[model samples]
Target: MKINANEIKVGMLIEYKDDLWEILKTQHVKPGKGGAFCQVEMKSINKNTKLNERFRSNDSIEKASIENIEFNYLYDDEINYYFINQKNFEQVEVKKDIIGEKGKLLKENLNVDLIFHEDKAIGIELPNQVQFKIKSTDVALKGQTVSSSYKPAILENDIKIQVPPFIESGDEILVDTRTIEYIKKV
Candidate 1:
């Protein structure tokens, strides 16, 4: 489908120069002397390369058709991660690199969306927030209430994140997967 340049948004997959690109960021610029244009930062899906391009508002771009399939994450064997399709019970193995850093947030039976382009898995999308148990953290100080401060803590996944001072080990809390920030106690 063709879309106006101004309609581009982060996370959208589009075709440019015969290659698929994922939009990472976009900025609409209207300089004092020139016509308005959109500055976009995109990553090549096939080549794994980054690019910056400018498109006028009147320019139309091809938006790639993508399909989202719900899959339940099963397990990983240090080499490949496995997922089972919820609708058909079919299983697929995906490389660790395809899951990226967010793979650490994945727990057994967690549901995620697998993005497909032409029946090939292009990427995986995790939930916005996930619940995790704090592994270890320092106790709140007796008189440290003067200012709001966050303390570093390790999660069950061994990922370090800053949480409110009152949070302690063994507490279950919701964390924003994208930013790795504490959302609230669960």
Candidate 2:
């Protein structure tokens, strides 16, 4: 699909110069005394390097097509993580680098979004927020409000997250993975 530079977004994948790049940032600038233009920051999917370039207001770019499908998390070894296609139950393995820390949240049978370009798995997008129980943390001090101070706590999955001052061991909370921030008490 063809898209204008002005319409680029942070997470959109685009093809340029025979390579795939993910849009990291974009800005449409119209100088006070100059014509309008669009500036973009991109990260190369293959090389893992960032590139900054500018385009005219009307420049067109190729938008890479990706399909997001439901996949069930299976397991992970040292080098790769595995998922099963829910529709046909076909197994797929994606490199650890592609999934990064997101693999930490995967539990057996959990459904997740897998991004595919044609038949090749390119990325995995986990849910925005996941519910986890605090496994270990100091007891909440008396008279402390929720906003008083944050204490580090470990979730049931062994993921480290900061919780509100009033949160103690065994408390359930919602965690925002995209920003690695605490959302609310669960």
Candidate 3:
């Protein structure tokens, strides 16, 4: 389907120049002299390359039609991660590069949406919020205020995230998978 440039958002996949492009960043700017435009940074899903482009607010772009299938995480090997459909118990394998660092967030039986283009798995989307335990974090000093300070911490999955001053090792917290940021104590 076609969408106005102003409607573009980060993480949306759109077709342009014969390739599927994932929007990495988008900024709607209205300059003093010219009309408003959407500045977009895109990454090619197939070639793994990046591009920056601008679109007029009135312009329209073709949004890629993708298939989203619900799957439960099973396991992974050296190169691929495996998932199984809950309803049919069918299994599928997706490449490691497709998921990259996000693979660390995968745990047993976590339900995720697999994005397919032309019947090929291009990406996987994790749930918005997932629970994890803090593996380790620095001790907050006595004089430190709790209002705006955030401290670096590591999760049991070994992913680094920032947590509030009150958080400590072994604390369970909810994390936002999209931004990999701490949401709240569980």
Candidate 4:
């Protein structure tokens, strides 16, 4: 899909130079005495490169076609993750890069959205929030109140995350992996 420069927005995926780029920021300027143009900041999907580009107002660009399909997480072998296509029951192995940070929150049998471009897996979108139990953590102090401080805790999968001072071992909490913030006690 070809779109005008003015149509780009943050989080939109675009295809340029045979590579996928995500729009990180965009600004449209119509100077008092100059032609209108758009300034865009984009991050390469695979290479993790960030770049800035300016385009004339009327310029057109190809928008990458991304398909999001729900798949059931089957397993992982320390190198690749296996997912089963819910619609067809066919399993696919997604590389580590595609899983990215979401790999920390993934649990076996969990469902996730497999993002693909031209039938190639590009990203894995985990659930907005996941509940994880703290496998190990120091005892919470009764009167040692801190100002919104977080302590390190280990989860069942051995993923380490910071939790509130009130959290203790054996407690479950919902975490927003995208922001690495503790949402609520579960």
TM-score of each: 0.90, 0.90, 0.79, 0.89
Candidate 3, 52-159: lDDT as tens digits: 999999998999999999999999999999999999998999999999888999988899999999889999989999999999999998989889899999999899
lDDT of 1 by residue, 106-138 (tens): 999999999888888888999999999999998
User: Higher-TM-score candidate among 1 and 3?
Assistant: 1
lDDT of 4 by residue, 8-36 (tens): 98999999877899999999999999799
Sum up the clashes in candidate 2. 0
- Judge candidate 1 at residue 53 and give its lDDT: 98
* lDDT of all predictions: 0.92, 0.86, 0.94, 0.87
TM-score for candidate 4, please give it: 0.89
Clash totals for all candidate models: 0, 0, 0, 0
Report the Cα lDDT for candidate 2. Answer: 0.86
Best by lDDT: 3
Off by over 4 Å in 4: 146-149
| Model 3: residues with Cα > 4 Å off, grouped in runs | 1-10, 25-40, 53-62
Assess candidate 3 and give its TM-score to the true structure.
0.79
Predictions ranked by lDDT, top down? 3, 1, 4, 2
